[model samples]
Target: MVDRPRKPSALATTPGLPPQPQVAFSADNSSVTATLPTGESVSVLLYGATVVSWKDKKGEEKLWLSEAARLDGSRPVRGGIPLVFPVFGTAPDHAQTKALPQHGFARSSRWEFLGKSTSESTPTPTTPAFAATATSAAGAVAAAAADMSVKLDFGLSSSGLSEDARAKWPYAFNAIYSVTLNTDSLTTNLVVTNDDDKSWECQVLMHTYLRVDDITTTTISGLQNATYTDKTTSPISSSTQSSPLLTISSETDRVYTPAGDSPASVPIVVSSDNKPKFTILRDNLSNVVVWNPWVEKAQGMADFEPKDGYKQMLCVEPGAVGTWQVLEPGDAFEGAQTIVLGGKTE
Candidate 1:
């Protein structure tokens, strides 16, 4: 027997690149986790394409998730960034969305994870010409590549909706949600496309729950002169934000809209003791919703655990809830918000 002829295996002939250290998927593919070279990471659940956790490079969690939040596909996740779409809250009496539930179906429907890609902050070409560069230059290029950020995409369409949801809002539509994890920031963008023949009206909101050491010590800025709809009242009264920084002391629920011709791209900052904690900047989102169940409301909700959980979290949501953004047939609307983590604390 000729034992001298062992063929080279495929693995031996072609070596495979190591697995990406920046992106990972759950065992059941129900979630994804993306990490940066700098040690920061973001985890997203496919249930609602909701961001479950976002941590700084030092492993400090920034997003708040309720302890009683349902993650078994039973109900929409209560915290983190649960998306609200097609309708803001309590479907208006309008004919289009009169029969829908509060906050629409985006957060309750299961989304398909569309995989991920990465973008280098400072792209370094690895072409043959660049490969021939000096060792020092090559080292610098490798260093820049290490700063690449990971972006995870999720998709949901009318065809993918449950029969109950599809029957309620019988319109052909598609939505894509992207979450990008950077070293010091997390950016989430949503693009909704109307595939129906007729136009439709809808609203979008990014319900972001930011974790804080103490709600009493936290204050939200950048809405001083903005007009807000106080949803805490029965009739939903309107008022102008008098103070430069607003502190939460009650069951707060308000939708802050741009005042007059104020730019819609202003940065909403959350701070404690005058030190910035999180800075939220939005694009194409003109309204911001600040919410907290406080003591009474918190104890009333079943999903809100610890009863006093409201004292450690604040919902600084960036949204377009003031008015409906009408989308024509075959058209698309995109809105995004970037949350930059503030300076690292001791």
Candidate 2:
């Protein structure tokens, strides 16, 4: 059971205003949920700081979770947006990440819940993309706070790691992940700091799994003409995307990178029957991965739940995985991605 704060603060009950959004923790303190006054809500588990659920105002889920996903801290949650850090995938040839598990330890490690805050803002952030804006903007500038939003912060540091995980990657580092929920969108931001005396190299990815009515009716737009590495191909092939919209019919795993004058922050749309369903906008994250395990691959994964679940979910991940980022001691790297539901057409 979750412990919800039912007592409304005096200001929240003010005569003409709507009740402020509320954030609550589970009775066991293993997870937390934030609910907007309008009825949208999001929940995050401490293990890996994985977002387990995100519901719209009408209670429709936007993110998918595998039925077989292990939520007991035995492994990483297999859905929603799993944070991949230090390494994107298996790197047997790299000296720095060779010993670390695929996608590093961030996803499987437990994170400290730093707390929650609420604010009011417009749909678009000031910096546009890849930046942290005011949380509790309602408190700082009460007069300007109109539309309500909520944010939850989670933290992980080297000192909090288990003995075996610490031994594999000895660098001291700190990671902060923020999940911000608005009326019509969800935004996630990650900041990594090299806390060790020596510099280190790493990759970060927001591996987002979006729920859809049917995969066959879905098409992704915005990568046309951009170059992508087709990981599903033997020897891995790279080519420009010739189609304005891409669909998944078979096993697909391609990482798209911007080429020529293509901007990295361009809006990527996932549509169903030519109508927009989700719009992804990213900043400082140069790569986008479009993947679907399809039939064979989906059946082979132990935690993928029903073998046919692939038809109901798609992984449209925004990441900084095309190249490694080297951070100097005391330096930090930040990246963000925002997913808007029922996006507007161009």
Candidate 3:
């Protein structure tokens, strides 16, 4: 058995606020930072998270996660990894969506970060050294603190669940999300537990937005021969049988399933015409979703890119589709995905 390091000391908790357990870890050059309150964190490449945010470097009050990746620009500050549960995207029947707003209420909600001392079991592997590095970096933010990496946990509260959420889907469920940044990559893990007596069914996903210098010039692989569904058209089409590999042209929206049962370990390499490659490795996920609002649609989104901003980024999500996952009373379900930076291909 791999020797797990001792759990760090108790996190300093703020009175009247949810337990904000912040921890830190460090390796050599890279560091990670996590806040248990929001499960929000940052990985300092010593360079930048991914792309350099000119706005952030200038000391503007810009949201770090906003410029980092996965921050739902349109939603509240509880950003970074917006947890989409009970459903992803829109419901098959548009009428059924009236009660819910946007992407089913997890993003804007605040979560409680169960402190570091608490023991939790998860399907994914735990890297204590990496967690340490992350937390240590966070400490550096304070003038008197040391450099380290940290891992934080957040739990969903009844109050945190939005009114819109209750109107659309009424069920008791608890979700715990953790974000950990290591020297080489960022890992996000989500666990949902059903508290109600009846089994519940719903689609689940992690909407990840990646920052790039130029989307038009970036070439993304891993979907070659993989199957996908085009959301633009009501009737889903298979990219595998017809349009196998996907390269961004104008506007694109497609959901893909791995070619086989093997986890999608292959890097979804994204290379710009002249820049480095950003590799996305998805694991334990059933589907991959690629989307871009394009010209007219981009304008429709409250916080999406301007008509031309579509050329800056792409959303390649890892999710479960078509059928909704059913969780029985007291049962919990978990899934994980990873995004690694640097290392471009020729």
Candidate 4:
């Protein structure tokens, strides 16, 4: 997969590398401080808009988004990025599902960084990189002289809602959430707009949790035949599968559906068995979620790690799961996902 070339400002250009650091925010902007070119330095916090912590490059705390519920205790507050929607897990008034907690509150609520632009002209380089393309329909498109990509836009206001999201599901919808990072890939675009006129049936997901090293020597390569649904027992078990390149071994959740448009390139290869370097690439997302909890739900979780952190990490995610996407009124729906880190290019 050897491509490499587009580096004009992937937030400070990085050809032979070594510049990187220039994603500031926080002057009451709430937080978003990337600075990686290996100097590592992520810091995304927006008070419940979620992503409360992400310290690496010698700081530690890789990933884990909330733990401490050995069935009912509490500590919640683990990693970054966690925004499932309308309803992601559990619902049937289990006491209003503990009054709306446990993965629904938009990763904790509070996200507003709608500012950043570049590109009105300038685009003509392509062979390995340097594209641009993003006229209007959102905005911003730059690439070259060091690399730069913008499409930033986020919303869900009322000072970022939370009265348990207006008493569990009251509608008045508006969610943009668009992001684009360069130097290979990081694209994310989610548009959910329904200004309440009628029709609204949510069930969306984006629980992206990636930070690997082991996960028992990772290997995810696009779902071969795709057609799953096995959210852990009880009247839920569809088939027409194809994903047995095995190696997981325990508590694994599943949900896939993609057999058209020839879209499939999931690759998750981690191989820390000594030498295989790193690999990530999740192009446009076609759906591939393979989880692990092992040990009877890791003994009920309180931060999960027993079993040697379940061999480290692995969570393929790019979703729609359990079906529920019905927007009317003002109607709007968009989805795109991509993440392409380095290593592996034979």
Q: Highest lDDT, which number?
A: 2
Cα lDDT tens digits, model 4, 1-346, are: 8666884644654343224345787776666655443333444555433444444445554444444312111223443445566666766653323345555666566666665443222334442333333442112222232354334456675336867577776677777675554443445567778887677666556666666676677656445576778778788888855664435677888877656674435554444454433354444445656676766886676566453555566665665544567788888766655554445442
- Which pairs, if any, clash in model 1? none
Encode model 3's per-residue lDDT on 61-143: one tens digit a residue. 11123332333223433223456666676675744344565566665554554534322221112544334444553322221
* Model 1: how far residue 193 lies from native, Å: 0.8
Summing lDDT over every window of 10 consecutive residues in candidate 2, give the lowest-scoring window: 137-146
Q: Which digits, one per residue and each the tens of the lDDT, describe model 2 over residues 75-137? A: 989898889988999888878888999899999999999988888654345533213335544
Q: Which ten residues in a row have the lowest lDDT in candidate 3?
A: 46-55
Clashing pairs in 2: none
Q: Can you tell me which runs of candidate 1 are displaced by over 4 Å?
A: 1-21, 123-142, 260-262, 343-346
lDDT of 1 by residue, 151-179 (tens): 89999999999999989899999999999
Q: After superposition on all CA atoms, how large is the RMSD of candidate 3? A: 11.6
Model 2 stretches with alpha carbons more than 4 Å out? 1-12, 121-146, 260-262
Return the TM-score for each candidate structure: 0.88, 0.88, 0.66, 0.29
- In terms of lDDT, which candidate is stronger, 1 or 3? 1
Q: Tell me how far the alpha carbon of residue 231 in candidate 4 is from the true structure, in angstroms, after superposition.
A: 2.0
Q: What is the lDDT of candidate 3?
A: 0.56
Point out where model 4 deviates above 4 Å: 1-83, 93-113, 117-143, 158-165, 169-178, 187-229, 232-338, 341-346
Q: In candidate 2, how many Å is residue 238 off?
A: 1.3
